[model samples]
Target: MLENEFVTFSQNFLDRSGNHRSNQKKINEYLCKNSAQYLIYWRGKVPVVSDVRDQLCWVGRDHPLVLNYSGMPTFLGLENDIPFFSINISSWLPGNYNEAAAGAFFDSNIYNHPDLPESSFFAELRGFMNRISAREAELAVMTRGINVWQENNLYCSKCGNLTEIINAGWQRNCVNCGAFHFPRTDPVVIMLVTHGNNILLGRSHGWPDKMYSCLAGFMEPGESIEAAVQREVLEETSILVKNVRYLTSQPWPFPSSLMIGCVAEALSKKVLIDPKEIENALWVSREEMLEAFSGNNERIYPARVGSIAHFMIKKWLSGSIE
Candidate 1:
């Protein structure tokens, strides 16, 4: 489907991106034309969504601090064809803008910015991404990933000291030690394990009722993706898997995770569910899956539409994943 076409965010794209079409000359020319760049900010875990939660509100576009693009500020990468840049408001805007002085950034749920409109708040980035270039959306996701990584990794693992932003927010430098830290994306393996007429699906706690998805687990240190898939399925559902094959990957930015999609052959038919990892596990037949996809089956519900779990399962049912 068209929903999954531009969904795959590859590592090669991120590794080679950043200022792809912008040179000093082009950047300056664009800035001189009164076209401004904005940095969309999120507080705590909640993205600053609009009242309707439809679009992400932009700062410095026509706000209290009208930022000029010609003058340099920190870039947060281009998201949806719009260049995002963060300015040290204290350094750029001249006024009494300091509300809380506890290092300018905090990680808590506070009730401020009450007057801002939803249009100036959080955005369903996926929906807005359709209007922009692929590379721009990818960059925006990366910036958000970097922000999440920085928030979680404030305290260093090597030394119990706070880290400072360096490399233009790409890397962090620890003041206590000379260690440099980079962003981290945890790798998880999500597979549609199948044999003959059935495919394995499991549901975790806190999920919607009757909903199931491909089994997934983090790839542990020094473990391969194939081994991780087999191990996860076997551990959670007690189903032995063989001939595991890699299919595709998705950049799941719900706090920064890279999902590795796969298809594994089920070596055993019996299922022994691990209550700790799953609320329930089942092997549904092709006919049942078709019903689920068509929304006619009351026994099971497919995974959320935008997720790779849904994509993998749909592909499997259509005989396209074999």
Candidate 2:
């Protein structure tokens, strides 16, 4: 698949040296030797810039502000021969300001590091993922996902005790009960279903006006991916699907979700919108979707540009789907 067709957070240029994750002595050595570059993450946003229009710049090894980190940086693997690390700062980092009413956590923490260049400011991961290079996007995606996990998993679930960082910040140990817990990643299935020349698209209740995309849902326990696709499509749109096939997946790190993308051939086409699951469901013809993709249609739009739904729809339109 072309790199442009990938959903955000799917590209990784870093060589995740799993070899060092469990080796504390080596990590400490790297940290002490001043050979480590850093990615500063605070409440899920990172500093980014394009340098050129519609591009993203990678966080550098020699940025001056990296000198101020006192917190123990989390291991993010190595790029080239230099070790890369990430530091999680408070929600209000050095130059962050308070906002009156920000909707999500991302909006709550738009920061500007004091030492960064004027052209670079902290941006929410999603806002700039589309414009950045694969390496830049991967850094933000990996670090943001791990830090968000750390934030939510500060306490042990079983013993109701505080957990200590272990395994180089990847796992945590409960002090009171001596239980070990690792990071969490929820799995989701986002699928494209097609019948004849039309694709099944559904919109949630609060989605942008007239915007629709592939029907999706979480996979239940004891269910296979193909079964989940069949069940979710049937439940949401009353559309039966067969011949389900897996495509590429992406890490949607708003709170660490692995979106497994798929395509399924529809067995039945009668539309039955499940108000409980979706607001509206329709069969969008390929020609009509082509118009929407080209921005010729005013009332309806396909999925957002950086989403798996958009990728699948475009691939199908281009006759590239296998």
Candidate 3:
């Protein structure tokens, strides 16, 4: 019973004008408009105004960064007649930047651009996902996901030839094989399994200590969502599950993944951890989970906010998920 709007990146506030993506003339017209604005990205990080509320920083087409940028801007969509676009300025690097820190699991370093406002700095989406509005979160995730896909998939998989951007950054055409490729979104299932009064949680290897969340696994080809949920739970914790029901979903664009949230009834409670799959597995009662969520439990850390796991766990704690 989790509400859709509360989920980050789940809002549909912008109009994704798909029909106009292939229209070069229309795209050019929109680009030239005064109301058009562009979101800037560098090395997978987005620029945001560092304030009490982290707002997405948008610059005009005539800005120094945009003018100096070398590639075509990807048309995101229209927000109330105002066209929005995204462009990667990854080629521009800040002085004394640490590549390792920027690529860390939780990067807190902020990179400021000399040409942009002093209040604006580049930040990771996961760091401030819960601080921004749902609309801005959606936009930022969309821009980041698309840019990452474009960067990593520049070459054609069909023939190993270079591909050119098309359909306003939504599609790529292979120059040699004439094949079309679209952005790839891998589906993953994160489920909450329950038996009697306890819920299942597991922590993967290399995760921060004491941090545990719902068991999750990537869905393989030719597999149903429910089947994936059951198989993953069984494989990781040796727990048999039944009555697999979907609750919600979140667009986890850490590298383009759609998290399918589900609730399953556990037939057994004994946990046998699979070392290759996860570091540890445990069952926590409802009271212990509530304590963990409130930060009162010292031995357990709940899922991070702005994630579907956290949302589903909260719903289950409130007796909303059957």
Candidate 4:
């Protein structure tokens, strides 16, 4: 990949003002500022213009939606000194809400708030992630990741006591035990395992038909990135790899994960299936991968656009995986 190129959610677009996170006075000042922008989220979905899904629907601090929400908004970061925050209004229910659709792998349903503009609808970030700019993607993912963490970790793990948001939503403090907890990000190793002219690809059991990407697994405790890459590949595909090297990284916040991308040279090519680990695994030649990317392959669909897998594969195909 080019030096300046970055995958979705990987760009440094916002100055996360860590210094001001602990300052209650500063945070309150930003919240009261008329120019402060807020991104409203509902059940992990953000509002975007239906006609053109290029930008997030940002509202001022005094917007009815903000005024109606009683919960505190999490401070995201600063963009050119303009404070950005995210508020969750998941309590509000829409007339056309489909619970099943909202919980799907990719929610296709669009929900419009009665108080908001007709063109603005809450949509899954993955649905229009590629359509928005890098800065917007970063903001959306940060908001979603933080909100998900807060919702799931309402109680302290150490003491099982209710926790309260502190440090401008950056940390949580236990009301009873006084233990402080921070947002957690699990590390995962996603590797492009190659044997000569072929690259390794695998698909999970319930992935869309023909949609395959690089082999990946969560990194184990006390394991290094290189060691995790080898162990995961061996366990999942029965393939041994050597010369493991790090590539780029992406912050994948589906539920808070840091995808550590790598390139490895396969030492053995024999195929061995692990049904529980993955539905199927295969080695695709460069020619076939190119054809798949161009939509000419009959049995293969490349990774989703704007994903690190897609970025890594494209880089490899262009002979840029250095």
Each model's backbone clash number: 9, 0, 0, 0
**In candidate 4, which residue ranges exceed 4 Å CA deviation?**
1-4
Assess each prediction's global lDDT (C-alpha) against the native: 0.65, 0.77, 0.91, 0.90
RMSD of 4: 1.3
Tell me each candidate's TM-score.
Answer: 0.74, 0.89, 0.98, 0.97
- Candidate 2 per-residue lDDT over residues 97-184, each given as its tens digit: 6554244423634455666666766766666667776777787788888888888888999989998887777888899999989888
The digit string of per-residue lDDT tens for model 3 on 208-280 reads 8899999999999999999999999989999899999888899998889999999999988889989999999
Please report how far candidate 1 places residue 121 from its true position, in Å.
3.4
Query: Over 4 Å off in model 2, which ranges?
Result: 1-7, 50-70, 93-110
lDDT of 1 at 218: 90
lDDT string for model 1 (1-322, tens) is: 2234645343333332245333556444433343455554343222334344333344545544444333344345443345555433222221433346322322222223333443443334543444444555555565566666766777877997998775445667788997988878899999989989999899998676898888999999999998999899989999999998888788877667999888899988898999999999998999999999999999899987657887788787778877
Model 1 poorest ten-residue lDDT run = 102-111
- Please say which candidate is ahead in lDDT: 1 or 3: 3
In order of TM-score, best first, we have 3, 4, 2, 1
Looking at model 1, residue 67 earns an lDDT score of: 43
TM-score of 2: 0.89
Residue-by-residue lDDT tens digits, candidate 4, 1-322? 2452668888887999999999989999999888899999889888997667888888998889889878778999888789999998888998889999877677888899987778898998888999998889989999999999998899999989999999988899999999989999999999999988899999999798999999999998999999999999999999999999988898988889999999999998987979999999999999999999999999899999988999999999999873
